[model samples]
Target: MLPFAIGALRAIVEMLGLCLLGMGAMALLAGAGRQGNPVYRLFELITRAPRQLVARLLPGRERPLLAGVLCFLLLFLLWLALAAWRAALA
Candidate 1:
């Protein structure tokens, strides 16, 4: 029971982190589209690192919506994996 509680807590924390990361990425991408300023570029570089890595491995053009869906899928998978790990440990 204690192990289950701990696992749930860990999963919640991880979900929050992933949500924040996804939101930050979206914000940076939004900034990248703005005209007449380079400030967004810095954020774009930071947030784009993961997407760039994915793109490199996947090797394809991805639409914004598709990217968003992928993020959601990845987060969901992470949550599921964590939950499964917790259950197994218990």
Candidate 2:
């Protein structure tokens, strides 16, 4: 049961990290006008969940992109720690 939960969390963390990377790429290549378009909107939607989570975690920060980066780092660290622990347990 514990291993299952850890695996699930690791999967989620990986997904979030990948989404953030995609968001970053979209930000770099996509124009401001394209934000309303479907591709950009999809990236925005994927990134929004982590942004909202980050916003709640860091209330004082005004920059959402920075917060999202921090959020991705946080999840990555969690995933790494969990992987280590699971390996140690095994």
Give the Cα lDDT of each candidate: 0.57, 0.80
The best candidate in terms of TM-score: 2
Q: Which pairs clash inside model 1?
A: none
Shift in Å, residue 15, candidate 1: 4.1
- lDDT of candidate 2 at residue 72, scale 0 to 100: 81
Give lDDT tens digits, candidate 2, residues 40-61.
6786777687788788888676
State the RMSD for candidate 2: 2.0
**Worst window of 10 by summed lDDT in candidate 1:** 35-44
Poorly placed runs, candidate 1 (over 4 Å): 1-49
lDDT of 1 at 68: 42
Estimate the overall C-alpha local distance difference test score of candidate 2.
Answer: 0.80
Q: What is the lDDT of residue 6 in candidate 2?
A: 82
